[model samples]
Target: MSKLDKTNEHEEHTPSSSFSREIEKEPGGADIQHCIQCGMCTASCMVASVTEKYRPRKLIQKILLGMREEVLTSELPWLCMTCRQCEERCQEDVSLAEIFHAVRNIAAREGYIPVGVQKVVDTVMEDGWMLKDGYSDFIEDDRDDLGLHTDLGWNNEFVKKIKKRFIDGGNKK
Candidate 1:
């Protein structure tokens, strides 16, 4: 047998494991095995419409093929907007948005968070909101000055608790 022929034979015979099974082992990955690659999810995806790199259909295919590492490391998981449109459109009723969120959390726990996401997380940790210095800094007027009837309050304790519960818990919510 020739070397090229042997290599081809081995490649053709490799058994594919279920990447969906691995992801579904996690919290938000339920129903991932139901995906049937109907392309409806991708067709309705706002991110996919604007960017060629983000495609829910393709992501499902990669997962079904057991490309766990590639799916987790690539920006594909982060591109989802969690709109649930894909889930609604899915013929198999797969929760694509939830699955994406679950995968993103896993990636973050593995220290694979993108720089932009890290910055937002740091901001949330520092302040009660995701914006740095809080939203008050962006506005020039106080509640009283703006003639607002209600008063705005900042609870540092609440922010601390959230950090301890979420971020410190390895981004597991």
Candidate 2:
């Protein structure tokens, strides 16, 4: 057999153990196994409409095939805007948004967070809530003039507790 022929063999790829099942155990991921690769979800996806790289059906296929590492490390899962357009069009009732979120949970725990997501997490950790990265020094002067706290009134203690309970506990998100 030619080397290319060997590489193309269907049997060369072995599905990992229960990668789909792992997602199924996650919230909103239970219906993943029922996906029939109908492509309806992809047809209805707005993200897929706008971007060539984001394909919902393909992601499901990879998960069902147990391409665990590829799925987890991919930025495609995070590209979903959770608009539910795909979910509405899905005949199998697969909750693609939820399934992707579940994948994100697993990916985050594995420290595979995308840069944009990590920035939000970092902001929440620093200020006890989300603040724009451009929150300027001049805002302090304005707050002082208005007799308001320069450090917005967000509860730092709550953020800290949440981080300790979630991220530090090995279930990082």
Candidate 3:
């Protein structure tokens, strides 16, 4: 093999054990002791299987090593679908999905919520709904569609009752 070819081969085969150690220092870091390094989480992760750089196993390694800069800022962190497939497949019950959430939460607290996710959060905060469109768009006349009685006055009464119950339950806010 040529010199360049040899370098490429080394890069492809070398495991990132050093980086894995840095990740372990992170808050709510993945339990490295629990990981068998069996690659089951990576095998089951939809994000990892599709994106070579976003492997859950690698992420756990990163967390173990305290690689906060790389772990928090990487697009790979946000790419997780939070499907819990890795969690389900792990014989160790490592809760990779929860680990992903913790990482994402840390990123968000540090002002790293991706623009796409930030936009969704903004919409929900402003509209009290996931979609940005007006409430009229969601409200419907059909009883089945509304999931309640079609009578508008009855609906108002129902809402009042709910509000009263909430207040009585000390949920005034």
Q: What are the TM-scores, per candidate, against the unseen true structure?
A: 0.69, 0.66, 0.58
How good is model 3 by TM-score? 0.58
* Displacement of the residue 169 alpha carbon in candidate 1, Å: 32
Candidate structures ordered by lDDT, highest first: 2, 1, 3
Q: What is candidate 3's lDDT per residue for 1-173, written digit by digit as tens?
A: 54335332321122335544433344544444466567898988777767687788877767655677888887677887879888777766666766677778778878877788888889666434464222231344565585886555535643544444343443423
Model 2: lDDT of residue 170: 36
- For all candidates in order, the CA lDDT equals 0.71, 0.79, 0.62
Writing each residue's lDDT as its tens digit, candidate 1 over 30-97 gives 66766656799999999999999888888877877888789888878887888988776666667888
Pairs that clash in candidate 2: none
Top candidate, metric TM-score: 1
Please give the distance, in angstroms, between residue 119's alpha carbon in candidate 3 and its true position after superposition.
1.4
CA shift at 131, candidate 1, in angstroms?
2.3
Off by over 4 Å in 1: 1-18, 137-148, 152-173
Off by over 4 Å in 3: 1-32, 132-173
* Each model's Cα RMSD: 12.9, 13.3, 12.3
